[model samples]
Target: MQNSKWVDVAIVGAGLAGITCGQTLRQSGYTVAILEKSRGLGGRVATRRLMATCADHGAKFVEPQGEQTQQLIQQLCDRQLLQPWTAPIWTVDAAGTLTPTEPTPRYVAPEGMTAIAKVLAEGLDIRRQQRVVEIKSIDAQTWEFTTDSGEALPLQARSLVLAIPAPQAVPLLEPLVAKGLPTAVLETVRKAMFDPCITAIATYPAEQAAAWHRVGALQPLQHPVLRWVSRESQKRSMPGHEVCVLHSTPAFATQYIDAPTLETAGRAMLQAGAAWFPGMEKPQQLQLHRWRYGFARSPDPMLEPLPHAKTPIPLVITGDWCRGSNLESAVEAGVRAASLLEQWLNSGHD
Candidate 1:
């Protein structure tokens, strides 16, 4: 077996949480490595290029709430990495009456939402397509991990962070509990719940695009199938055609989560969307993306990353699921997780 160089910290799931955590730790002079399962970087901050245009199929936009998130947003804006989505957002009630939403600024990237991840990921050591399969505590101050890469050797680190969803993280930590490690943290991770979502991206001809020219996006209230519809082209400039992103209700996603074919589900969502905006049923191009852990259910805003137990090394479990189901929450959690890990290291726990 080949031996790889040990790092100060190794983080799983190169999503927002993992990237943010790694970035913060690196600023503190720690050598960090971010391991991602997917070829893409951002977890939910995704964008798809189909037909002649692109659409943000995962997170529509980011609305900063907390102080840290606001500061991050301002920094991104100053660098021209992000811009305010000043387009009008309207909400549709059950009676089909549309009303303008509050004039709060929603931020988006000019190229795509994934640009945010790319910006934060700059200058970071991120290993993509490396799905961590096993983690074991090697000693009082070291941990080792093996990925699905079919390599004989495993990576070692003084500290580790599981920044993926709870369901995905549980299996990796379960084996450690047998060695008297992370039982308390495991229970807390188990308590976290997530809902699935089915997102549909459709592009319409210019004739149909003019119908909704005044509206930037629509939130359908009390809808059984469709939950949100946004003109993705408005966020950028896509000529000759319009791109729209459709999000299915959580209930609809739950029912179709295990469908034999997702095409049917995608069509069904488009059909429902047509009821609100005609011509959505028939798009020039269509794409579907399913998120298994789309949103966290009733996450406690006051909660921080799960505190480590009396293990030999420092281990942290964190994600958007640790707090709320939003980009801002994920950023806040990552910052906090980095701080906690630093504390543990400073106290000579690892």
Candidate 2:
């Protein structure tokens, strides 16, 4: 049955951007719903359990560079959702020469990385596994969203916030140009570009990983295949086995982005990493993940307040790509997007 729901605002992509936008709107007494395509939250702030231990496959740690990010970290720490990872970061050359890096503050979640998203998602109406396939303007004041599966009912809202990746958001927004959607908005979204990334999770015997107590995390310098390798156990205490997460260079990911299978790419990354970290070539278990839009090559300019005067309706585009490809960028974009939609509605445009 294609039932329908009406809300003050509807958000696509329950990543930090969508969740942040929804939370911001809900605080103003607006009925909002966040639809997520995946079962998990936090987008790239993800973690996975393997064998007795877990590995942070996505962003290894959070380093607050700005005041806003620092404030966010302090809040999370106060709530016990975040803790400082005082481990040292080192740089490794192609020939496996390790050099010490300057000390910096990095934070992590003891429970898991996704815990950060869970806390931010509190008291919000978040619907997971809701893949939005189509978007339509239902008159000037309302927008409708159709899910990929028939099990979900269509959602209608007075305003819409697209918090997904630029590449994914383009398809849904393209057809709306004929329906009064601004070509400039679509063109701005198109200006954003991303580089692909391939991540591999590997686990080895606990004894082997314990041997490298001096090693924290390694950033490969000018490596053709491997870019980063994280020793998961170094930051957090885990038992039974040692976990390592490897990230491939953008060039490597581009070459294997459309391959029939990623097994070859995964193995190549692990093999390349073995040069710096022994036993990486052999693992008890291995898992592979591909991020088609991993890092932004070019990000859209940060529009503090969207130009609502020229917009046809209360719709805003937002994502990490709207600013930069970091967690802070996503949060900031969400806040700006929410501010735009709120202004549009309050100005009697809704």
Choose the strongest candidate by lDDT.
1
Predicted candidate 1 versus true structure: per-residue lDDT over 1-350, tens digit per residue: 25677889999888888899999999999999888888999899898877665789988997778886688789889999889899998989999999999999789887888888998888998888888888877756677777787553356788898999999988988888887775777888888899899999888887787677778999999998988999987798888888889999999999989887789999999998877678889988888889999988756654654545548567888888777878877887898899998997777773
Give the lDDT of residue 113 in candidate 2. Answer: 85
What pairs collide in candidate 2? none
Candidate 2 local lDDT, 281-323, one digit each (tens): 8888889999998887634355445322224457887887777
Q: Could you tally the backbone clashes for each prediction?
A: 0, 0
Q: Pairing residues by index, what is the TM-score of model 1? A: 0.95
Candidate 1: which pairs clash? Answer: none
- Give the runs in model 1 whose Cα sits over 4 Å from its true position: 149-154
User: Positional deviation of 243 in candidate 2, in angstroms?
Assistant: 0.4
Clashes of 1: 0
Cα deviation in Å at residue 321, candidate 2?
0.9
